[model samples]
Target: MIDFHCHLDLYPDALKLLPIVSARNLFTLVVTTSPKAWLATSNVFAGYENIKVALGLHPEIAEQKAGERLLLLSCIPKAKYIGEIGIDGSPKYKETISLQESILNDTLTECERAGGKILSIHSRNASSRVLDLVEKNCRKSTVVLHWFSGSLTEAQRAQDLGCWFSVGPAMLRGANGRSIVASLPINKILPETDGPFTTNRSAPLMPWEAIDIVNTLVPIWGIPKEDVILQIRNNLAALISEENFQQNHSDTK
Candidate 1:
């Protein structure tokens, strides 16, 4: 199973769960909320080939952690995945929208300079602006919008910009999320848990539990669960292939 976006390190027993996740052979992308957390999380998961740590500065805390921008940039070359990064325009963070956009712009610019890293982004209520920055700076990067809650038009815009979407069980449970998933191109869809934050029955979801997303997509796509699983796996393979090619090209420069 592939969990394209998750906060693995934030789990209470993350250290203990690492071996379980490895044994399951789950390919998980663990996104950090701040650069300060990136190094420690990266080091913790360094021995696991299937687990990748994305350097990030979540928009919710972008203003509070604004001082970490340079640290984020300095770590770009070593990070092939950048994520949990984007603009959040919910009423709570609306006032800091400008600062969030600036930080996102800088992050994208640095990622472009580092030769296009795979990005797992958070749009929340700011999908349009997030797409704007992504398109303006990292057009060539592999961009995955996690738990996208935008309208079909915005989703189509993202698709037109070559962005991918990561859907999880919590998201699929909602009518709007289901509709959005149905509207998205099947090939561009990936499964994610966004776990430890998204819960099921009041308990935090785990990385391996992302497989549950297949059951949810079965009816939405009108195919059997197996086919849904195969499609998601294929999508992940294709994404990884592109990332590998980009990495190889960057190395040659």
Candidate 2:
């Protein structure tokens, strides 16, 4: 299973058991909430092969602190994606929108230089601005919007730009998410469970729960489950593995 976005740094125990968990061959991309998490997250996945880091400042970090955040992010060479970064219209984060945009723009230069990187974006209430930024700043690198809670038209716009999307367990409970699962192109779809953040549990999510989310879209793909799994896994390899996407996929198979 491909876990598109998760905050593995927040759960220290997950790192220790990774070898055991990865032994079953699950591919997960652990995203950092901000520069503050860069070091700890990188340290956790230091030698692990199945896990990778997606680093970026979250909207909650005030604009005043963006410079400090960017400096910290720049120091982390291990980060492969700029993430969880975008505008939020939710009342709590409304004040953070400007700061989010600033960080995303500053991160774009670094993100673009590392060609073909997979970005895990957060477009909560600002999907439009996210789209605009993707067009202007992130078009050079590959993009994957996590838990995309956008309209079909917004999804189409992303598709038109060749951006990918990851559907989480929430698709099973909501119309918007389910609708996205039903219409998104199969090759561009990656599946995840957002895990501990979803229910605030810390035991860690097994790969099967992620598989269940992908299963909901099986009818939409009209292919055998295995085929869908394989394709998504291919996307996973391409997005998360550095310089060996094809080779990594071959070994996984």
Candidate 3:
């Protein structure tokens, strides 16, 4: 199974959890909320091929730490993945919309110049703006829109621009979620657990919780369970395969 968005550093037992995730035959993206956290978590999961630690500067905190935008740019060359780096247009963060856009623009420009970074983005209430920037600046990278909450028309626009969407437990429970999933092409769908933030019950979800997503998609897509699993796996491979990664890396040169 694959979890395209998981905050490994936020877990209570991150150290203990790493070993299990490392041992499992799973592909997971360990996204950080900030560049500082990325540095620490990258070191912790260093040399583990199965888990990719992404460099993220969450928009929720972008206003106060606008300085990190430069820091994020500097760290781009060393990173294969970029994420949790889009705008959060929720009421609380609305005031900092400009700052968020600036940071996101910087990030996309740097990634575009670098050529092949796989990005896992978050666009809470600012999907149109986020999609606009992505369409403008990112070309060689594979983008996975994590927990997209935009309208069907917006989703179709993103799809036309070649954006992939990642879903989790919360996305499966709501009617809007089901509609969004149904509207999207299955090939563009991926499973993720924005773990330790999104929950199934009282506790925050674990990375492995993405397994439930695969199981749940069976009936939703009307595909057999085995086929659903393969489709998801293949979708991930198509995005992060060695050939694609190498091509992106080569484009930078």
Backbone clash count for every predicted candidate, in the order shown:
0, 0, 0
TM-score of each candidate structure, all chains considered together: 0.94, 0.85, 0.93
Q: Give the alpha carbon lDDT tens digit for every residue of 43-160 in model 1.
A: 8788887788999999999888999989988998899999889999999999989999998898888888888889999999999999888778875678999999999999999999
Clashing pairs in 3: none
lDDT of 2 at 179: 79
Clashing pairs in 1: none
**Ranking of all candidate structures by their TM-score, best first:** 1, 3, 2
lDDT of 3 by residue, 1-253 (tens): 5688988789998888887775553677988888988888899888767788999999999976787777889999999999878999999999999999989988999998998688989899999999999999888887889999999999999999999999998888888888888888889988888988888789988787787877678888898988887788778767776734323222111
How does candidate 2 fare on TM-score? 0.85
Regions more than 4 Å wrong, model 3:
243-253
Candidate 2 wrongly placed segments (more than 4 Å): 62-67, 76-78, 113-116, 200-208, 238-253
* Clash tally for model 1: 0
lDDT of 2: 0.69
lDDT of each: 0.87, 0.69, 0.84
Shift of residue 85 alpha carbon in model 3, Å: 0.5
